[model samples]
Target: MNNADLRQVVHANSGTTCQELAEMFSVSHETIRLHLHQLGKTWKLSKWSHMN
Candidate 1:
């Protein structure tokens, strides 16, 4: 899946971490972080707070 798709999953499960997401998507942790950064711009403040 693309970053946007992965971001949606992350959004739905706010407590999940970048590493977890990367594992789930079979991507690198840095890849997850990049998507998270892009997603963060549009993500709700409440959601962003869940990042570790």
Candidate 2:
């Protein structure tokens, strides 16, 4: 899947980490962060939260 797909998955599943997602998507943690930024989003509170 693509970065956008991976981002959606992470967003859907709360409390998912950049490292974890990176490993799953075979990309660097920074790459995930970059995508999130491009999407105008980010994991809040330094930890993933279920609340949107």
Candidate 3:
């Protein structure tokens, strides 16, 4: 997906893990992490939980 699309997905699923988002986007966990950062957001344990 594009950067804008990635940002929307991140915003919609704020509690999603990097690994999870990676799978959803068919990208690497690091790639998702980068996108999150690019979107002015960072994936944290509190923001991204396995429970969610």
Per lDDT, the best of the predicted structures is 2
User: What are the per-residue Cα lDDT tens digits for candidate 2 across 2-49?
Assistant: 756975786688578889888888999998877766666667876654
Q: Give all candidates' CA lDDT scores.
A: 0.68, 0.73, 0.71
- Best candidate (score: TM-score): 3
Q: What are the clashing pairs of model 2?
A: none
> Candidate 1 — what's its lDDT?
0.68
Per-candidate TM-score against the hidden true structure: 0.67, 0.69, 0.73
Lowest lDDT 10-residue stretch of candidate 1: 41-50
Error of 3 at 44 (Å): 4.0
Candidate 2: list runs displaced more than 4 Å. Answer: 46-52
Error of 3 at 50 (Å): 20
Query: RMSD of each candidate?
Result: 4.8, 3.4, 5.3
- Clash statistics: count for each candidate: 0, 0, 0
